[model samples]
Target: MANHAKAAEYNNTSISSLKGADRVRKRPAVIFGSDGLEGCEHSVFEILSNSIDEAREGYGDRIAVTRHRDGSITVADRGRGIPLDFNPNEKRYNWELVFCELYAGGKYRNNSGENYEFSLGLNGLGSCATQYSSEYMDVTVYRDDYRFDLHFEKGENSGGLKKEKCHYPHTGSIIKWRPDLEVFTDIDIPLEYYQTTLRKQAVVNAGLTFELHDEYSGETFEYCYQNGIVDYIKEIGGEKSFTEVQFYATQTKGRDREDKPEYKVKLEIAFCFNNEINLLEYYHNSSFLEYGGAPDKAVKAALVYEIDKCLRNRGKYTKDEAKVTFADVQDSLILVTNSFSTETSYENQTKKSITNKFIQEAMTEFLKEQLEIYFIENKAESEKILEQVLVNKRSRETAEKTRINIKKKLAGNVDITSRVKKFVDCRTKDLNRRELYIVEGDSALGACKLGRDAEFQAIIPVRGKILNCLKADYDSIFKNDIIVDLLKVLGCGVEIKSKHNKDLNTFDLANLRWNKIIICTDADVDGFQIRTLILTMLYTLVPTLIQEGKVYIAESPLYEIAVKDKSYFAYSDKEKVDILAKLRGKYTIQRSKGLGENEPEMMWQTTMNPETRRLIKVMPADIEETQAVFELLLGENLSGRKSFIEENGYRYLDMVDVS
Candidate 1:
């Protein structure tokens, strides 16, 4: 009886509910999805969505947002101002319903077209929830030749509602609020967030202008896309696109189920296939979908189906060839999808995605029909797209095979004694003290090996000019025995940037055997070419080695000055000039011979000795410019190469091997 009495203490009265503003102020993540900076940013988006909805409904065309220096945000829109007076039907003031209540707004009767038909803020929770989560909020509305103002602090009404008659040029609302520090752990939204969000909104909402003012930076930015997604697609595709931009738009009314009500849907798709650039963006009701749900599925399904059907009809695939996938098409495709629906089934209140079954079905069917017509009408474009997508597919498959083979070939402990040919390793196992010298040939390698510190220095010889990695494919480049042996000697695996070859990315800096990888080549045209080829191989396959400051160039003397009983080495013309100016006795100057002809003492003093030799660290600060130059000189850029050679060929006239 005593145990039963103790348990019976938990009764109906024990069940408590959060009341008024406490409902949202206490558990903010319940509505905003988090209590961190993301939630604070979503709160700002919630307010901005209301303004976007008003502008999208044709009530306005311009919206202004401001990021105040004091951590407040303001969103002002030129639209039909929010009603703040009394409501006869509900027998409550509109101010109370909009500012205090949670689920109260004018967007519910969307199908009737009385309010917002296709709205971004349809849940009726944005305005009130944002107000409740604010430390202080000031709302100003201009309508009916009257200006109404309301102020709230800490989720409570302050000074009630203030109404005054004034002559205003436009009817709209301006809301400035500071998110509460107590409610959220972080509220410092960055300017980049606003720029990206407003740009995406402008892309979806055609002809709507969004102006952002950052008081912290004292700068203003404007985003307006007159042609909407079409313009965005062109901007993303740039001049590298092979196909002209294609735009398709349609609207339909449908229902997910017989029991569900029918709603209207509008879809706009803009796409182009580019060789150098690719992007995929999806938006619904002006909200960018970071995690695309329905439209993503629809696009993938329709494109694969239509493209595969076209390829089969044209007999482009062999008997045993596999069908293309979305990845294959996506490799060169730049597309943007903007869609809206009156009755949306959002995945959550944050509104990152929608799960409406009818929307997906409608979009998929519409895209399939349009694509079939497009392929039939534009034969040239269809051919180009088909060829490019096939190339991508075949390349992806080959890369996959190459990745698997390379992983298997390069995996395991690098036993240099038996696996790597002619790779002389240092006696020490300490990576910090070890060095690897990549010399020109076997003769140069013999000289370097004889002169180098055997306790810490190792030597590997490149037979001749290895494969030009910048101009060759991965399979062809890796097939070279010299390159394979060099990589095996280095012990650190390669890094491949392709998504298909991601699994083959076995590079780990800790696995590198040497502290310094010194490229030691003769100072001649052929040696320069050999050095460039070796550097290109490292740049393409093991870029991380250069980025981590592990690669270096061993400077070989260009001139050897023999005087009395001493010889001074000069690596450049300036060094030779300085040395000649400092000489006090009769001396004979002679151009240095190749590394193969150098004596062991000369090699040690000039190239192998750490205390006397000069090494240039290969920095990766201008890596992009280096890559562009490499591509122009060796990769597939014939016009660029021609232009560069024509403009700057004179600089290297002496270095050219005319003989």
Candidate 2:
């Protein structure tokens, strides 16, 4: 009985309706898509869209926008001002219908070509909804040789329309408003948003100018494109494009379905292929379609079909080569599609995408025909496009294969300490305290293992000299057991910079197993050569370790001096001379032996002890200079390497091993 009573309490009285302003104010996301910064930005765009529509309709050629420091925005245009006079048809003032009502606008009669043949403000929600969501709005209109002013506060009319006789150069509308903080969680729209939106609008609406004044930054910007997307594409592709820019345009009539009304569509496309740059943008009715619902599908289908057909006809494919995909074409394609229609079916009020079926079909057919004609007319350009697209396809296929092989090789659940042969791990699993010593040869490894603090120090031996990673390809480097085992012990993957091998890169600095990677070797030529090889491998495969200050070199003494009961170590010739000068009584000095010949205590005191050992942190301040040196020494710049050796070889002659 109690449950039945509770359910019956939900009656008609409990389901009250939201009133005029409350409909949008209370439930903003339902109309604006978000009650956050995105909603605020959309509200601004809504006001801007009206100005853009007027400009595109030949009413105005310029629009001015100002972002105030107090979080208010002003959009002024030279279009025939919005009519706010009485309307007998609706039996109400035009201001009431436009500022207070929903689903009422001049664009509804677009099919008759009476007003806004191709309009961006299609939903009629832009103006009223934006007005409803603002803290305060002031509208000024100059039309009919008179000036009209209206003000609203908190979605309610504050003052009746104020009309006055005035003389003005051009008829226009100006609106200034600040988004309500109560309705939106955030309203601090960024300046970049204005710049990007205005730039895109200018690109689509050719010959139209947009001026932006940012009071916060005290900066003003202007955007205009005389040739629209063609000019924009050239700006992006630059002079290095392999093919010239191609433009195509057509106008047609279509309907989404038999039940839907027919409408006119104007399509324009501009494209070029560049090896160094690639971009794709879509716009409809001067509105940037970020998601690109219909045009995106149409472009991908047409380009892939046409390119694949050409490759087959030209005998560019192997016996069983798969057809090219949209990604392969997109890898090098720089394209822009600007289209407008009398009627549009936007996915939502925000208008990020359009889902009209007829638009897709029309575009696909038009693009296919144009591409066929272009290929037949320009053989050289078509051949170049085909070759580059084939190269992209082959490179994608190779990257996939390499990615799979690398994943398999690097995958396992087995304990790394047990799987990696001859690799000794420390007892501590704490990453911040753990250290790794990469010693040269088995003899040095044995000594280091005996001398290191087993609680936090691990050791790995590099037998002989490993492959020079800077000169060797990835496949050869990975095939070597020494490098592979070392990498496995380190527990971080490689960083691949090649365009074709991007998929093979799986590096994560957080997964590195050690806090410090110390290279422990003798102070002789062979030991130095082995150390350089190890460093080259690290610089090639995992430069992030060195960049993050985790790599170090354990400095060994060059001379050992014994006086009475104390032993002193000298790391350089100057240091040796200084130590001999400081000694008072009889002293014996001798050259330090290799790492393998040092006793466990001597190794600990000189190479492994945290308090007494000397360690040089390896960090590159200028990566470009470091790269140049590495390339001259180990890369395939043979002539450069020869010149460098001729100039600097004498300095290293004493360290060189002729035996």
Largest TM-score belongs to which candidate?
A: 2
Cα lDDT tens digits, model 2, 1-659, are 34543355766688888989898899899888899999999999989999989888889899999999999999999999999988988889888888899888788873455588899999888889999999999999999999999999989998789999999999999999999999999999999999999999999999999999999989999999999999999999988899999999999998999999999999999999998788989899988889999999999999999999999998999999999998899989999999999989899988889998999999999999999999989999999999999989987887777677677767776898777878888999899999999998888888888898999999999999999999886767777889888888888898998777877788999889999999988998888888888989999999999999999999999999999989999998899999899899999998999898888988999999999999999899998988888888888999999999899999989777687
lDDT of 2: 0.91
Tens-place lDDT digits, model 1, residues 446-513: 89988889999999999978999887888886778899889888888998877567777888888888
Q: What is the alpha-carbon lDDT for the whole of candidate 1?
A: 0.91
Model 2 misplaced regions, further than 4 Å: 1-8, 110-112, 467-477, 498-505, 563-566, 584-589, 622-659
Clashes of each: 0, 0
Alpha carbon lDDT at 353, candidate 2: 94
lDDT of all predictions: 0.91, 0.91
